[model samples]
Target: MKINGFRGRLITADHADYDTARAVWNGAVDRRPRLIARCGGSADVAAAVRFARDHDLEIAVRGGGHNVAGTAVCEDGIVIDLSAMRAVRVDPAGRTARVQGGALWGDVDHTTQAHALATTGGIVSHTGVAGLTLGGGIGFLMRAHGLTVDNLLAAEVVTAEGDVVRASADEHPDLFWALRGGGGNFGVVSSFRFALHPVGPTVLAGPIFWAADDTTEVLRFYRDFAAEAPDELGTVVRLGTVPPLPAIPAELHWRPAVAVICCYAGAVDDGERAVRALRRFGTPLVDLLAPTRYAAFQAATDDTVLHGWHYYWKSTNLAGLSDDTIAVITDHAYAARSPRSYSAMFHMGGAVARVPQDATAYAGREVAHNIIIDGVWLPAESGKHAAAETAWARRFLQALQPHRATGVYVNFLDSDDDTGRVREAYGDRTYRRLAEVKAKYDPDNAFHHNKNIGPG
Candidate 1:
């Protein structure tokens, strides 16, 4: 199963670094690929794809290798590694940027910040731009701008047939729409061009924390505040333990806390005034909000969580958080096993909701809040934490039954979750259209590592 002339590094199981190469972000996933192709460029990617198809080998495409499910590495087949192609090109005048498949959000941020601009990106800097955008990215700028996919202008993809082609609104438009939020089901995206917005050379943004006992008051206040927040301001409320840090008081370390992390993308004075209302409403344990560089704000939590930690995350869309829903969240908030585990709800309606549902593959725009339950634990405690997290999330979902959206966020899906639920994430018509597109572009279903819809 070797292509002697292919211009890339082909590593077999016998390779010296095969064990190291096969590892992914989450230590929970352990897959061993028979062969790994360290793709150098589009040509190398195409060759690897063809070789895998010819040999009937399962195929996996790894960008930054950050997928929580480890879809980036196959169990017994070929992996097309794109880590070498981390180039980013920013066009300041055009307010756009072209990012390579393997580039992380940090790469995009660094490149765009040089121009005092940014695209919609994930909250975490280490998350790969490719997967996040492909899965309908939600982040600080989402309310102000839109999903990361909404900012996407074009993509260079290597399809199932080993063809390198461009997808945009005017060219291969169906493929373009699917690529926007369809995950990696149709092809491997080699590069993406995205429209950028002015975020900040310096902006008002940071985390404001309150004690766990204040969760109810803080959440209720946040619900109202976020509902009326100006489009320029985006906030995510997280319930978790305060990390043991020098900045945090010793008495509060490891204690439960409610945090409202705010980002204001408008004028400094306007941001100050808007955030002031939040600061004054609660008796905060820590108020870290102030004027800061957008980059600094983006990277603030970068050190808290590292790769290889066991992570179980589930996400759902809510029309609005009702009283029952808040109670469910509050009950589970106190039962979290790992101090690092948390539940977060992001206000998702603004410029994002204004976009028509039929405009792209992303169909959850009508949802008001994006809720995620993250269970982060050490390797030894994974089994113990998994069941509780699952139960808590299930109970919470049931409580919000009437408010839940039919669609789900593909990025936050768990492995054992129901496949039927994927369709629910896209609604009926959009799911049907996505299936058709899957048939047209990926008839063989070679790219099915994500929240997949089989070829029609």
Candidate 2:
């Protein structure tokens, strides 16, 4: 159990914190690893990679451990837990942030916002920067600043063979290309340097909710509004119940409703003008949109999708939000079995679509929206409720199959999703290209724990 030169906390089965070490963010995942290496930095990560390879143990790289698939901790394998390595250094003069792979979106935002600089990050502040970026991150800033992957300037990685290297446009360029959207199939990224832009200390943003019965009309309006909205106007449509919070009317607590979560990264005056039509939309149960601190709003709704929840998700890249597609989504939302379960549609386009289709490993540039059918519940309702939850997510996906775009986001893939689904995440050509890069960097497929692009 001794890992030579591994200068980090190594937790074994007998370790006092073994149970805690193996636990990831998803309550549905109950994996027991033979070794949990709490990496201190790149050297520790390299040592763990070498140890895992020498022992023929599967390697699960854990950043934020928020991956719904629970691939962050493998049963009877080695987990390269990077949670302790969170360190963010901002270069305000250069407009860049060099962050450790373990850092969460909140860490990056906290540091970068001090200098009034930011980059695209996942909706939840607790989500890992590495996993989200590697799989083509979609977030509030995406419409204006592009995806997190698009902002990724460089990465420091530990290869499958235990070699430390840097990947960027000028060094290990091929590996850098794959790192953008190729997931974790190639290497374990120890750190990332991202291109940052002037964001805000505060921006106009929040949620507006309507009764579930008005979802149809809301969808139609959103489809048109989103299509024409300026790049600064980013939006997310959610069909779910209102959380029982004081900000909302007490009577509306836990009531089925549809919401438009809006963030405008522009002048407050212009943003006011931009969202005026939406503010006037059919009788809303509540309208909370207002000028808010950017970093604060990023985690505002985290309570709804908290850690340790029993999470199962099925997602797709939609070709467009046509009337038929909206109908299918509304039907599933109404028929959803669990009150905790809901459907979400993320608006895609603007800076994300402007990127060339073949520019990075991410190939969903033309997709107008990314939809997810999320099945969530508490552990107390876990055992028998799994079947119904699983069925609902699967059936929801099947209903949207015909309207799906060319590729699904790899980050959204579930733990049991098959290799065919992985291929679908990347088109045949991009997947093949990624495999070539995989073969060059990780010929043995040591990092197959992710949405893998197997080495050819």
TM-score of each: 0.96, 0.98
* Candidate with maximal lDDT: 2
Model 2 lDDT vs. the true structure?
0.91
In model 2, residue pairs whose N, Cα or C atoms come closer than 3 Å (at least 3 residues apart or on different chains), thus clashing, are none
lDDT of 1 by residue, 203-261 (tens): 89988999888887888888888888898898988888887756567888888888999
Q: Which residue runs of candidate 1 sit more than 4 Å off their true CA positions? A: 245-251, 383-395
The weakest ten consecutive residues by lDDT in model 1 span: 392-401
* Candidate 2 residue-wise lDDT, 248-273, digit = tens: 78998779999999999878788999
Instruction: Give the clashing residue pairs of candidate 1, or none.
Output: 406-424, 407-425, 408-425
* Each candidate: RMSD: 1.7, 1.0
Best TM-score among the predictions, by candidate number: 2
Q: Which regions of candidate 2 are displaced past 4 Å? A: none
